[model samples]
Target: MTDVRSDDRPTESLRDRIATELGRARDRSVRLTEAVDDDDLVRQHSPIMSPLVWDLAHIGNQEELWLLRDVGGRTPVRQDIDELYDAFKHPRKDRPALPLLGPTEARRYVGTVRDKVFDLLDGVRFEGRRLVTDGFAFGMIAQHEQQHDETMLATHQLRAGPPVLSAPPPPPSVRPVGAEVLVPAGRFTMGTSTDPWALDNERPGHPVDLPAYVIDAAPVTNAAYLAFVDDGGYADPRWWSGPGWQHRSSAGLTAPMHWRRDGTGWGCTRFGRYAPLVPDEPVVHVGYHEAEAYAAWAGKRLPTEAEWEKAARWDPVSGRSRRYPWGDEDPTPEHANLGQRHLAPAPVGAYPAGASPLGVHQLIGDVWEWTASPFLGYPGFAAFPYREYSEVFFGSDYRVLRGGSFGTDPVACRGTFRNWDLPIRRQIFSGFRCARDARPDETA
Candidate 1:
């Protein structure tokens, strides 16, 4: 993990910044709640999950615990704040009974504590001693709030809460997009050789071959896959693989993880915000089971990692390997909808300039595509110098996934970087495009 040094202004005096962040967190809480109703706020899919209102309280409680009491050495706020919001004890259930202040009072609590902590920090003159407690407290608070941000998205995707939309995502642009065309059968190196950010399983840069095949021009989108769902895709067992069938049955997945059908067209629900679903944006949060079922229903299959890379990026227009689909010149805004701007996947085909040689619309960003490959070490693959890296799950439960998502740091993202997860998992940032053995005419 990168160790971030405390900023030069670590002295407790910067009450202003803390106050700003506290208010910002409260503002975010209000925005997240704007679309959700009391009934919806109380709903949850899993037993352990907390309510949005509870989440807001915990966010403040965490801030107070770390920055106020721990670092600033101030008398603790109402002692109940710890008992109410303590994640280690409370786990997931939302208890409105935790003595949480009303929205107005919660905002005040956060703001006041922030001001006091900052005021304390400004006066402390350390003999250059690392303020480990203070530094960790700040970082921990940041992480705590970030977890809520994710929970906000997860709650929306699950549709456990009523429909909500705080911000309307920008409309999809008027850009014509193309799909991943065919690549000829051939052998090529797939997976990362260097520690170009190798996940635990992508080590050993395995060489794999692809028979002639066609891949989807891009990821399966809300519009395209909706046809399968409309045709009773979920109810049909024949369309799912053995394991996929079991998963679908248990999870009771009926639609793309992030989509909520409003009226006729679909809109994505995340962070309690709903926007018109991009007809061409990759359907996200659907795990391997959903991806497989979609492929079977559509009479296509996911590409093997080699096949996916071969068609989408490997056969680059230039012979040299570039980190991204377009070329090696890192990424700019137009190149892909990375960064945290929308804080969610862009509509597919938004990044035409970033298309791969095969005309794949979003070869790099928007959603991390699931491939047919299993997570495994490569031939002659050894774990990197970092011991916990690749050796843990050689032939374990994880499956291979590729292409980073919209929220990913584009600098760390690349065509070859690999990620993995258990098969049953689904969330808003994960999804797969389809690929299949090609008819002779379709092969490159």
Candidate 2:
């Protein structure tokens, strides 16, 4: 198979690759938007998330700012609406009241920007400016669109209606029953140094020394979480921290979000329909606090951010890190679940082909696995383009989530990619797997 990662490609091939990626990203966004009506596009599903129309236009505005203005040296096309699309200036709750563009106007504005961008690409030289040198600006904008595409899919799940989005289920997984895998103590590179399109948070790869630890071969399953719930894990304050206990009490969260007791058994809603909770599938829509409580109840803890990366990418024999768990190869349907290919997670112990060298499974895709670490930058971290993308949220306030979910696009997901959210949020596609420290006398 040809390696698209090679840097020796012809200039024309490079441009074509960029255009293909941008088109795929845009198509995915459009498909997600078309699933809902104009009323759904304008309605705010949650105060925390913008209406679908806002996301549609914001994707275009960012593309225009980075690709057309910054890289192509083109003048602004819609200067008056910049502030309306400025994410930092306007919160999601206030977006619905703004003098926003209607769905038709939003489509026309984005269409115009894209046409101008392609025209600029036709005659552009790839070697002079920093932003355009290696097609960095184009790659960044493509990634930005794909990220918002995932967010828009989340809005569709949050909106109340019959299921408008559909895809065939992932192929059944046939891996053996999983067990904890032990990672030996050693120094390993924790982030990226060579990925050209990597965001600032994953730069200046640093070496981290970690003691031996054991992590689950697959993410904690819904069946396992049910065991915790049956044992009064939520009602007992012993398994929760002070703040976590307070939040759970106030919210009255008995099970994961969108889950309820049906007669005698449990059922959960997905996209608008309720079905029996699949026992073998990895749990989703869990908050950091709930994950922590479950870990405590299981007599284990969430792995630190460094530990999770080490398990996913480090190869003990090669003594180096890889681009992904299955090596540098890009994701495929046979390897993992992603790109909104399915509405839910595959059964735990699925995707053996995507397992880490140490035999950890589903580390790349399933759901965003919550780590014990806070959202902080590595050594020598520097913000690129802007600080709002990552630097502003670096603190103990937001917890880190590693590994992408089913809604994530491959263009935006990688082994080193870092995602963070408030510890109390349960609206996202998030889940957890427990880890425990290895005994000093034990060996891998």
- Highest-scoring model, TM-score: 2
In lDDT terms, how accurate is model 2?
0.89
CA lDDT, every model vs. true structure: 0.66, 0.89
How does residue 81 of candidate 1 score in lDDT?
66
Q: In the order shown, what is each candidate's alpha-carbon RMSD? A: 7.9, 2.7
TM-score of each: 0.64, 0.97
Error of 1 at 312 (Å): 3.6
The TM-score, computed over Cα atoms with residue i paired to residue i, of candidate 2 is 0.97
Which candidate's lDDT is highest? 2
Write the residue-wise lDDT of candidate 1 on 1-444 in tens digits. Answer: 135356744433333444444444445556665556665555555554566667766777777766667566788876666776666565565464455566556656766766676676555444342333234334335534644654664555566444454333533755766655777666666666553333434555566765777888778887888888889998999999898888888888888776677898777767555788766667777888888888888888887877777665565445433456786667887887653445566776577788876687777777888887787777777653333434675575777778877655453366777767777877637888888777866643
lDDT of 2 by residue, 319-399 (tens): 899989889889998778888899889997678889988999998778999999999989999988789999999999999
* Candidate 2 Cα errors over 4 Å, as ranges: 1-9
User: How many angstroms is residue 108 displaced in model 2 relative to the true structure, after the best TM-score fit?
Assistant: 0.8
